[model samples]
Target: MNTVDEAPRTRRGGRGSRRELRSAIDTTMLPALKRKLPLVEPMDAAQIEQIDRASMDILEDVGVIFRDPQAIADWKSVGADVRDDDRVHLDRGLVRELIKSIPESFTYHARNPANNLPFGNDYSIFVPMTGAPYLRDLEDRRRGPTLDDLASFHKLSHMLPAIHSSAHHIVEPMDHVVAHRHLRITYSSMKHSDKTFMGMTTSPKNAEDVMDMCAILFGDEFMETHAVVTGNCNGNSPLVWDETMLGALRAFCRRNQPILCSPFVLGGANTPASTAASVAQLNAEALSALAYTQVVRKGCPAIYGHYLSTVSMRSGAPMAGTPEISLMNFMIGQMARYYGVPWRTSNTLGGAKTFDAQAGYESASTMMAVLMAGANYVWHSAGWNEAGMHCSMAKFVVDAEQCAMGYRMAEGVKWGDFNEALAAVRDIGPGGHYLGHPHTQANFQEAFFMPELFDNNSIEQWIADGSQEITERALKHVNRLLASYEEPKLDDAVDEALCDYIARREREIPAVDALNNEH
Candidate 1:
């Protein structure tokens, strides 16, 4: 709640004596990523406006379906043409006016004040992938994830230098009951990590429970003004905003917490086959959701969001890391900037079932597009595989390491000690190597991002080191991380209060087996 306590990214070490490089595998993840790369804007003003105008048309003429009666009423109250309790046509004037209340940027408060994240304008927060029904375990077994697996991810997310938020429901904890899984999920996130996290939006009650838990963890008075948590609301494609998502949106917006107004688009299936057409619809949907957030509580933070993946025409399956997706990301980024709101995008995603070369290439492509497109909140930044069907344990660690690598690139070129470096070059002869030079010694540790999972050693050295592949090495790092994990600071009374709250909620909610009807 206290802005004064905002933590800056810990400065890189100077002398080699007390130096510590940020490594995802080393479990020293406190300082968060602050992106510095220039945004990639491929579309010009005219092109961007074309999409914008198309989106406005979609909003004004085509209209978006709002399944929630409260949402429909809210729209009608705001001068929208409400044809019925289920559909509303929003005017561009009203949409823009309502959108004006959204701030350009805001702070996402973390339990550990030191880990607080700058949410909107300038920074990008990398988060782990969510909603993985199955997980490829450490022993290479593909199975549904359990509560312990969920806790393992939180621990890894806490320790991974590049991961910013614990990200609620990293994987569906199938071991826990449907009606009550949220309590365990939320508790695990708070217990395993002190970072900022997303709240469960499975049901309105679950959303309220996340807020209540947050109130217990962070004080009730503190939560009144500070945005400590976030929730994601996905719009059904073809311009439909169902009650399942609207309820969660209202719950988070009422508390003044941020929500991702994302449209879940499966191109050519739920949405138009044309990339530009789909984007226009996606944009209109996002704008309507953002506008409604203002209607719920004016000035509440809302992110311009979308989950982009083109459906394969031949196979009818979703594809990731495609050029079309990247192009759409660039266009979407430009659109969000024009609207003066933050945006989110997917990252480190692949269709590969195993953590192989295909996964690496696909993830790399996605990461490049995400950073260049200037996404402020990058979800599914790690461990996403098979187009979100499963989260691999090896891939999770490897993906976190890859995020660390991307973090370095997104930081862009540094020129802090440029003159000294050139002087060092002048001091050494052209033929002479600089490896032993004082300049190299002074800056080598922080000079480059050295990934622990990657093998940069020679063939003989690699063979001598047991010739382990990346997946094998990643699994080893995962085990090492869990073994070395330490619980972050949480007050004793607060912990007890959270425990008491969860125990009581378990008794209050009815027991259910499957995670059906996330309403």
Candidate 2:
């Protein structure tokens, strides 16, 4: 929690340094376009004012459904109108109070200072949620995720530079005790990277138990550096806050910890079978969370959590990383801005098959959409596919490169006081290329460029190089990176402390083998 710790030292020399090798295999990726794409563009100022007014009206009149009696009573004590034991009517006055308490931003510590990332208003960072897929291992080609697979995925995620944090126990690993010991396991992995947060279990009590363990790991100054015990909250239908979610919210507020209040609004499910309705649902859930923040502690630091997915009408399965999902993230980013909250959304994904066009197209499209939409922080930006059912280490490396490409795109055209560059452009005039200019050589790295994840080589060279497809290339790249990865150095004292914590927790929560055993 001490924000004053020294930053992590920068790593010396990696693949990133060899960015410009002019082979067709190395053509830099290019951003598709540069323009704001909004759900409702050019809504007049009056219309904008109307939406805000109407939203407030809904907060007060239509009210939000609160499934927790305690949250309702708490709101009632604060003078909010209570409709029932569970639903609380929140008005603009209450909303404003909550918004005031939330902080503009909060910092997440890195073991090494360089890895630390600040989340709030002006800064955004992305960390992927790993697990759920590999229903069968590709090696044994087994079905469902096993403990070893999950741990491997965790380590793979640990190596990503762009993915700033890793969600512990991505799926139910074999070490079920460690499942609850996520704080310790996460802290261990976190020794390698600075920003570590957790995916609090659906059960609020379980979430709290894990957080209590983390608090010990962090000592007294916990909130300042850790990702905090931020849980996911999903609405059943028509988008309403449930008891489980409210409990987590109240706990965080009471403890003065930040909450990642995310609502997974499936397009065509729990929402008006339309993308716009899904957007409305997201906005409503966010506002409700914002209102809760003000009520708990006026202006308490809260993150804008928007998770979007689509249900296939035919298969009844959730489809993530679709273009529609990315669009959903983009619109949600705007909603986050409207409320002046920092946003957390996920990036596009590869697929059930790690190395293929399906993965490439999906990841690329989603990344471009979210970046342009101005999403500050992206979760699950790399790895996992087939509706979060599996993860690919190879894909993780490829996605890292993709994320870098998107970040480069986001950092577009920085114009400065240097009239020299513009004047030089004028001097070079029509038909004059900058390829030969001294300034061009000096600053091309600063300009737009792509990546070499695929074989940018000419057909002849590609054929000569074994006709390796993107997937094959990505696999090789991932293994090479993993081979060179060095385990992070942690103080012996801290490591032992974490070990004791996990052992104590295991004694408390015995493993249940027969529970929820579906593959």
Candidate 3:
């Protein structure tokens, strides 16, 4: 343990110490949005105008199904075309006016009193992924996560490092009534996290309930920073919106929370059964959602979230966390930039069965795309497995290291004269190793990356050392991080207050009796 503790402590250099290496990276080119990857070009100014016109036409002609009576009344009172059944048609002119009124960027306050992070150009956040395929029980057995399992998962997530924000309702399998409880547990557990994601479900009442929770956290001032409770509004391909979710979206937007337009158009599911159509559907939905969001609040911190996957027809379930998904994430990121908005994507790195090569490959591939695409945020960055069905705390540490490396990669390389050494190459001529050079001694630590799991040795040396595999190395790293972990420091009074808030809410929420007697 002491030896491992000493490993990361060897380099005590300050920031900008590796400027030489950073210079080596191409400043103009973003590798994450390379040309080989499909870049969804944004519509030209005229095309965008046309799409807006056409979308308004669709809204007015086809109209959207709105079951929420209040929402229908609000629209109708505002001069929208409302049908007898509550299908409301919004005018293009009104939408344009709404889009024009929204602001482009905003800040989200972290629960950490020490930090208040900004979300928009040049800044990004990474959140842990939730809902793994298998739940590791105290008895050491692994199974699907029950509602109770989510409590443990949420608590652990609040403890992990580098998880700045989060998605809501990580685990399901409870009645709709339990959904708010799940949200409460997440909020209480994520007292350390700066931002929280909202899962609106299919209930408008739930939407209002989510807003109440946000108000509790941020006070009435939450309306300004309330963009904290970002809601993901996904679409069904080329032009379909889930009416149940749309109402929730409108509610969230009205509250001024950030909106993450997540469009998960699986190939063959809600799409033309082709990857191109899948991408097109994702692209179109993102555009429509953004346009709508802007219409609601002109510049309301919006992120185009692309979570596209291929469908396994035989299984009839979405094939999530696939390589193509990551590939598409990279492409979508470029497209997001085209629209002048930040992008958030997910990478499912670990799984329930084991944190083996399969986990490593899938996680690394997706994460590479995230880093390469220069995404604004990468959620589910670590500890996700079996397609977000399980989470491993050990894997969480391993993935944090991976994310750290990704940051290093994003930081780019260092470049300078003198072969990256102050001494001349001629002074330290060819074939004369620079390891002994003073410049090498001074700068080598800054240039080199000490990987937690990668082995840098000859085969004979490796065999002589331990004959351990990467999975074993990663597992060891996980256990070591857990053993050596120190809880993040917080003001005692603040912690107590937040905990009290959670306890009070927990007490007030009605249980079985309330459920049975509900009107």
Candidate 4:
């Protein structure tokens, strides 16, 4: 995980020049390998079809409650069976038909063109932990997050090669008013990182404000031609779409921005107890929101998001990185592929309260599941702890190193030019070492994935280095990154315009009650 001091400049030239193409290729990092299909299928085709049918039955018989009047009218206009002014029963055929309009893959543009991400089959992008209200450091101390903490996380995400995007609301800034926090967070992300970022989805006005700020940065016409941001819209489980999320969904969809239409399910609570029944409900909720994206504007990009995790029936505590959740990830991947739409899941999810061994194992297991399942858009890929209640800087660095390993593994085996290796083997036959072989020297840089945060020193070196644990080393790494943090240069005019927009919006929108209550 080598950190570049500055982002590489986008290559200039049309797609014709061979030298320019080579330069472009040299500048871009290695892409995640395309994973083979059906890495782990927990259900057979018949079972999947049965679950699909069950979901369709639920949609038709029980129907989902759409709290927004406009959403209800939109569904009614689309031939859905709307009743009681809120519930809408979507035909399975209509869901399938609307799904057809979604592109299998599309380019998500960034302010820096070189950082654009492609979402589709076999491509996985990792984003940092998001929506956490608390912050933890290597000292094992926890406190409410602030804008400064948020900016630090953004800078770390920008510095890490494994982190593909800086997610919105990386941590809730308790210091700022809820009405004005979104603007400050967005401004920090835009100012600190050049990569793609998510949009604020707390409310429709917040969503609009995010878009207006993006327009100030990337221009309205450029936004029309390219999707520079994405937003997550969640469905209230037990088959309900709340007005707040629907408003955000409409804002993103109508503007052609990508949305993650996710069902945030805690099994045995919001959904049924069984995994199969829970998955069916998840599919139904996700499909309803996805279809609504199309209804807003056909051909809009959307992802089938699954944040399914089972809660402890005894204590009713939410769990993460469980077997049930892993199975759900695999099943959701299969369904996303079947529908020919992109999919998203999480990484580094855990229930552990601290950055301890439990956190390590849980995060690793979940991340491996997402990678194996071929999730295209992964959020919470690093730093999540206490079942997403806190974000840890140490854990973020550790998970990032693990993510680099996952990227290398996704590459599978590369059997390039075996002649040199064979010659070396022949030369070093029978108990001889090939440590000094020519091939080893030539390919060492690309031969292995080097981790930046993990401690691999010998015992003597470790003792000499103060016997620092991984957490301590991680804290040092975080400090080093922030110390060397270089803000990506935005145009002076654009910066001024963004500041003006934020000030103007702050005045227009009165301060509201605190939105983030999870302390």
In order of appearance, the predictions have TM-scores of 0.93, 0.81, 0.73, 0.92
Select the stronger candidate by TM-score from 2 and 3. 2
- Model 4 residue 111 distance off true place after TM-score fit, in angstroms: 0.9
lDDT scores in order: 0.86, 0.61, 0.58, 0.83
- Ranking, TM-score, top scorer first: 1, 4, 2, 3
Please give the lDDT score at residue 339 for candidate 4: 85
Candidate 3 Cα errors over 4 Å, as ranges: 1-67, 74-97, 100-102, 136-141, 144-163, 166-180, 192-218, 222-229, 234-255, 287-299, 320-327, 349-353, 416-424, 459-466, 489-497, 513-519
RMSD per candidate (Å) reads 6.7, 7.4, 7.7, 6.2
The alpha-carbon deviation from the true structure for residue 93 of candidate 4, after best TM-score superposition, in angstroms, is 1.5
lDDT, candidate 1, 1-519, per-residue tens: 111112111222333312332333355563556778788998889989999899999998988999988888888787889876677888899999999999888888998888888778778889899999989887767898889999999998998888888998888998778888999999999999989998999887899889899989887777768889879999898899899889989989988889999999888898888888888889999999999999999998889999999889999999988898998999899999999999999999899888888888989999999999989999998899988989998998888888888888888899999998999978897799999999999999899888788999999988988888887777766765665566896899998999999999999998855555442
- Sorting all predicted structures by lDDT, with the top scorer first, yields 1, 4, 2, 3
Report the backbone clash tally of model 4.
Answer: 0
* Candidate closest to the true structure, highest lDDT: 1
Question: Model 1 residue 316 lDDT?
Answer: 97
Give the TM-score (vs. native) of candidate 3: 0.73
lDDT tens digits, residue span 51-147, model 3? 4445456666766555456555556665777776666666666655554444445666655434455665556566667545455443334565555
In model 1, which regions exceed 4 Å deviation? 1-26, 514-519
